[model samples]
Target chain A: MESHSGIAAVVKKTLNRRYRAERRFRRIGLAAVAVGLLFLAVLFTAIVSKGYTAFQQTHVLLDVYVDPDVVHVGNLDSADYQGLIKASLRELFPDVKGHRDKRNLYKLVSSGAGSILRQKVLEDTSLIGRRIQIWVPADDDVDMVIKGHVDRSLPESQRRLNNKSLAWVDALKEQGRLEKRWNLTFFTAGDSREPELAGIWGATVGSFYTLLITLSLSFPLGTAAAVYLEEFAPRNRWTDLLEVNINNLAAVPSIVFGLLGLAVFLNFFGLPRSSPLVGGLVLTLMTLPTIIIAGRAALQSVPPSIRDAALAVGASKMQAVFHHVLPLALPGMLTGTIIGMARALGETAPLLMVGMVAFIVDIPRGFTDAATALPVQIFLWADSPERAFVEKTSAAIMVLLGFLILMNGAAVFLRNRYERRW
Target chain B: MTTVGEIRAANPRMTCRQVNVYYGDKHAIKNVSIDIGRNEVLAMIGPSGCGKSTFLRCLNRMNDTIEGCRVTGTITLDGQDIYDPDLDVVLLRAQVGMVFQKPNPFPKSIYDNIAYGPKIHGLARTRSELDQIVETSLQKAGLWDEVKDRLKHPGTGLSGGQQQRLCIARAIAVSPEVILMDEPCSALDPIATARIEDLIHELREQYTIVIVTHSMQQAARVSQRTAFFHMGDLIEVGPTDRIFTRPRHSLTEDYITGRFG
Candidate 1:
């Protein structure tokens, strides 16, 4: 009796220790998950705070008197457009003088401002003789001063924009000439070497073109591969080998796909460099394994009895797959495809190898044109030494994240709208 | 329950001789032979994995879908060799339609589910004709009144028994000569099972039904003839009444009397 009681006490202690260990393990797991979520929150918050400022831009409204002699209709392209904006700024602040002060005054407007002045005269030829009011984008350094990003108390040697540039920005601000406007041009215009004139239009359009080709190529080919492999293929050592190879293909590093594209698509095929078509072709290879694997899983998840029911109703094998099985599996396939495409959208390395990392200034008009995708745009911006490019990079990240969210939301909606429980 | 000497109905619609099924190296069904009479309810009662469901799938060549599953020997329907290479499996399935163990209605509307088979087979030439086929099929399955107003609603929203009946209605919409039911009531409650049994009785007047069942009482109640299968072999087959009252085979008698399966 005494031994039995002792044994019971020992068992109870051991069980208590086991329970404590279990609790500790559970808590550790929960803490790990919490840490993961915390990192994501921190990352997103950091990107958003840095990027939000880029969405609004500073502009300087100028009333430049365009003398016809300065820019005749015949020589409109060769106008001293920068001198016109400089003269306007000089008139606004007549107290400033000398070559140094005059150069500082010209720095107030965007380097692209001269180009804008020329565009204004060319658009309405009558403006060449008239006093035209126009809004010109401010230079990035001067614009930073107006937006309170520049420290005025800092030594002139330590600052990117000196007191001379700050003085002109202050003059514009006092006269209600400098205003912050929603940056529509960022969405409409193409890439530029000047920070203020650079926009996401080129990269966004390139993304669209690449994705168009990626989706068009991957969906049908992936679905067909999945159906044939799952439904029709005979089981043998060779098929088993094929299955293993397919899974391995999915796990292969994406950069390797880029290299393959570099060799086969660009070098061997002699396709156009920096084309969305080649970028898409590379991404298609990277995306196919994901789609095919997910599509097969989607096809597998559908109960075999559904196929049997269709077959029992006299549906041909093709009819059974197309009419019954495909519809049932479509939601899963669509979600997988979207996720794969979203991953492709954020992929930079494969696109980089296919020469999609070029400084493309024009929005890709077609699949065969030179273009830079969004992630490559972010990469390029992040590499730039300019202070404004920091905001541009983060803003590009925000856009990329937004697109991913949209794709996931679309996936969820498709799944919910068409999914059947049974 | 007892099994008398083997019995044969007057007009056999399907005749199977030495049918064998193999799933890889596993011999799933041995040489099993049976006759399914025209427009009569034939019940196959067995314990699980006795190949009754497999044999039912054989009727429409539905076994062809399973990977590594091989079927050998002859199965004829209405004096036609169904395994003929030139024979269209699609047309054969239209004639020998099947109901699954679990009710599987398509993700489509009730009207569309019923219309699918007819539309695929080109049985309906016009809109009204297609509507008429759906109506009569639902009526024949005894689900018309309950679902008449909700024909456009998804078939999955129906109750369990209603869904099974909807599946039945879908099969009949194809105008099949034979309908194979593989444990159609195993998944249903007693009340639903009883409703399905009643449906089978009424359907026997028009289409031939071969139901694989696990319930002895269900077999006794619905089937005109019962075939007992054990370990991949047909042990006994006879009139359902005689099979219950005077089973000749010891194993058959043991299985039906609740001694042991």
Candidate 2:
């Protein structure tokens, strides 16, 4: 009786210990999940806090009266407007009497604002005699001060903008001369040398054209290759070799594709450098592997019985694929395509290797024209010495993130809508 | 049991001449020969791995899709060689449709599922014409009255029996000459199975039907001729009544009497 009681106690202890261990494991799993959620929350908060200030920008409202005599020179040629604007600005603040103050005021406005004014004058010759209220971009230091990047207590010698300039900015703000608009131009304007004036509009257009080219080329080619390889091609060494190469291509880094594009598109084919067309061809090579992999997976997920049923109904092999398999695989294929496009949009290394890093100041007129992408613009701004470029870089990053989120959201929507069950 | 020579006298639509099938090194079907006549329901019944389904798939060359599966010997339909290289597989499948063991209705509307084959084959030119094809096919599958109101609904949304009927309708939409059924009722409940068995009887009027069934009772109830396979060989095939009551081969006799699988 004593031995039997001892044995029962051991069994009870073992069972209790086992149950406790299981509970401990479950608690650890729950803790891990909670930690993951906390990490995501922290990341989101950081991105929002650092990136929110990028969307708003400060502009100096200048009421510069266009001097008719200077602007409308002998014959009033639109091309001479730039020189007239510079002459008028020089007359407004004579460099002799207020040389230092005038230079400080000039520094507050972006150096490229004169060029912008000139372009506007060229477009409309009648503005020479008019008193127009133009909102010129403020210099990077002034932009930083408005964004609270510069502390007021900093010494004049150490600060980018001195006390005198800061005083002038304060006066302008009090007089409602410095205003913050919605920054609509940031979304509509093109890339620029002046960080205060740079926008993602040009890069967005480039990305659009590139994605169009990728979709047009990759969709049909990828699907056809997948269908042939999955359904029609005989299982042999040759097909095996093809499958291996496809998998390897998917693993190859995007930069290699850039180099390949440089060699083939730029060197061999002599395509225009820095064109969206070349960028798109490079992106197509980068995206094809993903599309093919996804297409094959989608096609393979379809049950063999469906094919059997189609064949049984007297449908040919081609009929079975087109009539049954292709339609079913479309949703998954679309999700993959969207994912591939998102990856292409965020790709900077490949574009950098190709001539996307080139300084493109105008909006791309066509696929064959020079273009810039959002990430490339961010990289360019982040490298600039202007303090205003810091905000612009963050803003460009936000735009890039928004596009990525949109693409991924589309993928999720398509997946949820058309995902099928046997 | 009557020999293949005697069975040939009945004007068979399909004749398998000593057909053999191999999957890589394994002999799946050995010297199996059978004759199927028009409007006749022929049931091939045996235990698992007995080459019953293999022989049924051979009828439609569905085996062609499987890797490493090779068929030797001739299978002819109405005296036309089925394995000829020049034969269009699509046309052949259109003539000989199949319903799988598990109902595989395309993920499409009930109307569209039936319309798919007819549309692909250019069997119907206009919407009204396609609608007529869908209606006739569903009617033939014995599901038209029950589902006619919800024809626009997904075929996959149907119950098991209804989905199976939808697949049958999809098969019949192209107006195939022969319908091959591979364990079509195995995944269903007894009630669903009974409905499918009834539908099979109804389909025989328009199609030459061949079915692979695991249930002995189903074979007795629905088939006019029955083929019993054992160990990748056609052990015996004869009239349903004779094969069930007095199978000549010992293997067939043992299988029927439950002596062994």
Candidate 3:
């Protein structure tokens, strides 16, 4: 009786400590989860807050007389649209007299404003003699002033917009002629020195073409390699070495692939520089190991009994794989391929080495065209010595994140749709 | 040591002589010999890992799928050597079907599971012919009435007994002359086991079946002849009635009388 009571007393004492330890462990796990969620929330808030403004832009509505002589060049493409824009600005603010003042007055309109006027004239020849009112993009400096990014209390020398330009903007705003409109140019145009004219469309198209090439080349090759290794290859030292090398390739730095592309695709084969074709070839090399690894894992996940059943039913080895096992494993392979493509979509360092870092101004029309991917565009915008490019960089990041989410969502959907139980 | 009792069938469908099996360096089966008579059920009973299942797998060469497993010596099916180099293993398997220990229904509809074998062998030319083959195979396995209304449902959705019967029906659809069953009732309840035993009695009219079982009573109930193995050696072979009633090897008597396994 004495020994039993002593044992009971010891158990009673340690039970409370065990319970308390479990509670403490649970609390630590909860804290870890909470910290992860907090960081994610902070990242989203930072990107959305800085990038939402890029979706809207400031515009100035002005009435301009398209004088026939200024726009009536022998070739419509060579028409002097700049003169028409300058004459219209002079009409709006007639008090500006000196050459410097006149130049400053002309600075309120975007330098690309000539293209808009020239486009309108080319579309409608009847507008040559008519005074038409149009909403044109404001210059980046004027846009900054209107958006309140430039401090109005700052001296003339300290601010991007001087008092003279500020007065014109205030006058326009008071008359309800300066308004914030949807930034359609930000989605429709290409890279430009002027922030207001720069858009993500060109880079988006480049990314599309690059990924198209990557998928076409990598998916079939990766799946075939995976099937051969998993299903058909004999277990020997050679195959073991091959497997280890494939795993090692997946961990290799992506820039190494870019250098290989530079040396092989560009220099040896004389493929065009800065083309989506070359960038895609480099990305394919970078993503092949990832797809092959994922594909093999998927093939391995299939139950061995399925293979036995097929073979017992008199199926040849190839027929068994192609008929039953492949169908069951296909959904997994597709998920892996999409994940690899997403990684390739966001890859930057490899593209930079292959000359896809050029400031391309046209949307890529083909695989061989000079192009810049979305991540490269973000890198270039982030490095610019301008205040507006900061918002543009954030907006580009948002687009990239949206694509990644969409691809991952697709992977989940496919997995759930076709994954078999037994 | 030689096996006791008769190892020859009056009319044999498959004959094995001096067969040896190895897994890398481990000798799993040694000089085992048996004969499977046509239109009969032959039951092999033994303790776990006594090479009974290994010998049954050798009938259809199912052991070929296992890594490092090797089989030597001659095994003939209807007087033709099955291990010849030029023999088409696919055709051999088509002629000799199999049912696994567990009910492994392909993750497909019941109809497709039945139709898969016939379709692969091109046994049916028209769609209606294919449908007929599926219906007849299921009916022969005695699973038609229970699943006729839901032939399109997944085979995995069936009960354990129903799934096992569907596997039998899948094997039957191939129209093989011989069927190798590896512990067909080991994973089933008693009622399901009774159903499979009844199906085996009916199937013995048209197919030669060699079953690997653990229950001696089940062997006495369903099989016409019995083979007892111990430590990778065939200890006794005789009629099921005689093997259960008459005195033979001490190991066989000890195992049947519940003295030891």
Interface RMSD of each: 0.8, 1.6, 0.8
Model 3 stretches with alpha carbons more than 4 Å out:
A1-15
Q: What is the lDDT of residue A361 in candidate 1?
A: 90
By the lDDT metric, which is better: model 1 or model 3?
A: 3
Q: What CAPRI class is candidate 1?
A: medium
In model 1, which runs have C-alpha deviations exceeding 4 angstroms? A1-30, A93-101, A130-133, A151-155, A171-176, B1-4, B7-9
Kindly list the per-residue Cα lDDT of model 3 for residues B83-170, writing each as its tens digit.
Answer: 9888889999998999998998989999999999899899999999999999999999999999999999999999998999999999
lDDT of 3 by residue, A175-253 (tens): 8888889999988887988999999999999999999999999999999999999999988899999999999999999
Please give the distance, in angstroms, between residue B102's alpha carbon in candidate 2 and its true position after superposition.
Answer: 0.9
Error of 2 at B259 (Å): 3.0
TM-score of each model, in listed order: 0.93, 0.90, 0.97
lDDT score of residue A70 within candidate 1: 86
Q: What are the per-residue Cα lDDT tens digits for candidate 1 across B15-124? A: 88888999999888788777889988999988888888888889999988887888898899988989989899999999998889899998789999999999999999
Which candidate leads the pack in TM-score? 3
Model 2, CA-based lDDT:
0.84
What would the per-residue lDDT of candidate 2 be over residues B1-261, giving only the tens digit for each residue? 223313452878899888999999999998877789989999898889999998888888888888999999988888998999988777788888888899988777899889888877899889999989999999988899999999999888999999998999999899988999999999999999999999899888889999999998999999999888888877778889998898877888888988886
